[model samples]
Target: MEKYLMKSKAMHYVFVIIGTILMAVSINLVYEPLGMVTGGITGLAIVIKELTGFIIKGGIPLWVTNIILNIPLIICAVYILGKKLLLHTLFATLCLSAALALVPSVNILPEDYLLAAVFGGALGGVGLGMIFVASASTGGTDLLAMLIHRFKPYYSIPRILIVIDGFVVAVGAMVFGISKTLYAIIAVYITTKVSDGILEGLKFAKMAYVISDSYDEIAKAIMEKLERGVTGVYAKGMYSDKDKKMLFCVVSKKEIVDLTELVSEIDPKAFIIVSDVREVMGEGFIEYKQ
Candidate 1:
């Protein structure tokens, strides 16, 4: 058990490092040049740096400001959340702060705000998503969300994040001007969606439930050809007051055609309901988290 925990800790470190690097690169290389200040502690730091052009001999670096703000928030999380979470968040935030300090800012897509927003947001989102899956955050609004969720389970995490980040972005508009602020909004939206896609699994699939008289034959066909598991659920038709076999199956989006055709061929009037499944975890899909 100790060894397993050690391995998990090592993996968490890996996630923190990679995610930190990705975020640092995105922020430095892409967003900074375009002045796309998507809301966060980092974004607030950028605003402050721009506002105070040489207060302490030179303007404060983003990482320095990020750490300055995050310390109190991290302490709050330590008290509110727990030590394990605090450790992960601290590691991730420190790595991110270091990377931002050490890494040079360069403009790969110079003068193209749209391009910067697109790629920068995507890369940042990927980084954020990895950290999220590892059960840690880079502090800032993430930690704030946790603190809020602890007191009010009524408010969802996403809503809390939006409310917090939205306020920052609103303030950012004053610093970055309207044009850059608009681009920043675009970048922030893309970042949220891409990160959600990453954590949820980009390789989307479909979940289907079918009710038909020939469910047995369809199930056998699905199992044999698709090699996907099919569960038989006892279902009753409310309108007709008749009992029927309901087939619950999951398959890749590509297999939907074949499965539907097979069902149609087997039963001409099969009642089928198809729904979107953001993720799947089972014997065939991702293993359940320990």
Candidate 2:
């Protein structure tokens, strides 16, 4: 057990290191040079950096301000997201801060606003996605989202993040002008798109929850034809006040259409909910070998 715990901690550290590098590359190579303000503390940093040149005489610098902004959020995460999450987030945030401070300045993109916005957003989005997959974050609005999620699990965290970012972009517009605002919007869009793509790319399985009168037939078919396993969960219908069997299964996307069709043919009244699962570890799923 101690060995496993140490291994897990080591993996988290590895993720933090990798996530930090990607984030630094995105910020230094793309966002900062273009002045594209993204969401989160990084975005706020860009806004501040623009207003005041990156010149610090004494005390904490603008870069430090970005790190400090996450302090309150980190405390909240510690209470809400648990100790492991708190440590991972703190490590990831510190790595990001250090990377931004240490990476030698470089200008990769031309002064063209369009290129800057597009590439910067894409890079930042990929970095964010990687950070999420690592189960760590660079803090900022993500901490707020986690806190909000603790209170309202049903609320859409990404949507809330968008709203927060939108406000930041609005402020950037006021200070930087409308043109930069437009570029920032473009950058935000790209970041979202790329982040989603990266997350989806990391998905390993699909979870299917099936509600059907022909539960037996579906289960048999899944076992015999798909060579997949199924677990029957006893469910009580709210409106019908009748007990029913619901089938839960995880399968590859290759079998999704076939599964749907088999269910539809077996019971036209069947209800099926399919969702992408990022990672699954257990019987019939990806399992780590000892």
Candidate 3:
């Protein structure tokens, strides 16, 4: 058990390292170069980096700004949230700052903000997703949200994040102009969708509900032909004044067509409703591992 725990921690740190690198790559190569601020501490860093160009030759380096800004936040996080809870987050934040310093700033997409937005968003999303899976964060706006939520329990963390990040984006618009900021918004949206997709799990499936008088026959056909399980839900129809069993089944995306055809064949008048299932676990799906 000790060995397993050690291995898990090791893997988690590895995830944090890799995730920070990817995030740094997106920032330096895409967002920073294009003046597209997607929001967060890094986004604020980019804005500052641009604004300070008048004072400094190339403006303050992103890593410098990132680390300097985070120092106080880290100190507060330790005091407020405690050291134990912040160990992983501190590691992640330092990793991100180090990555920003080490990774070269090369604009791969040059003036093409569209490609920059999409690609940068996807890369950052996947990276952030991996970090989240490891139960860690890069400790920028996320940490700020936690800290705010700590004091004002009424305001949720997510709402705080939106307000904070939105403020950063708005500042970016003023600095970088509307056209680039619009692209930034697109990147933000894509990043959100992709990260959400990663957190929710990639194994997509379909859930189906069938309402028909011949539900028993349909259920039997599904089990035998599709090799899937089915459950009968007790449902009553107010219009028809009838009590019947509604067939509930979950099947892979590929099998949904087969299930639909089988149900239609069994009962042409069957009412079928199909919806997307983001992830499925248990028998014939994602298994639990220690």
Q: Candidate 2 clashing pairs?
A: none
- Taking all chains together, each candidate's TM-score versus the true structure is 0.90, 0.68, 0.90
Residue pairs with backbone overlap in model 3: none
lDDT, model 3, position 41: 90
lDDT of 2 by residue, 84-188 (tens): 888778888888888888874477876777888877777777777667656677788867766776788676455556678898888877767788779878888
Worst 10 residues of 2 by lDDT: 1-10
lDDT of 3 by residue, 1-290 (tens): 11222256788898889989999999999999889998999999999999999999999999888877877787888888888658888888889999999999888998999999999989998787777667666788878877887899787444566568888899999999999999988888777777666655788999999999998889889989888999999999999998989999999999999999998998999999999998787687665455
- Model 2 residue 225 CA deviation in Å: 3.7
Q: Write the per-residue lDDT of candidate 1 for residues 225-269, one digit (tens) a residue.
A: 889999999988899999988999999888988999989999989
Off by over 4 Å in 2: 1-7, 54-62, 71-89, 111-119, 130-135, 189-201, 204-222, 230-250, 258-282, 287-290
Better of 2 and 3 by lDDT: 3
Cα lDDT listed for each candidate? 0.83, 0.75, 0.85
Ordered list by lDDT, greatest first? 3, 1, 2
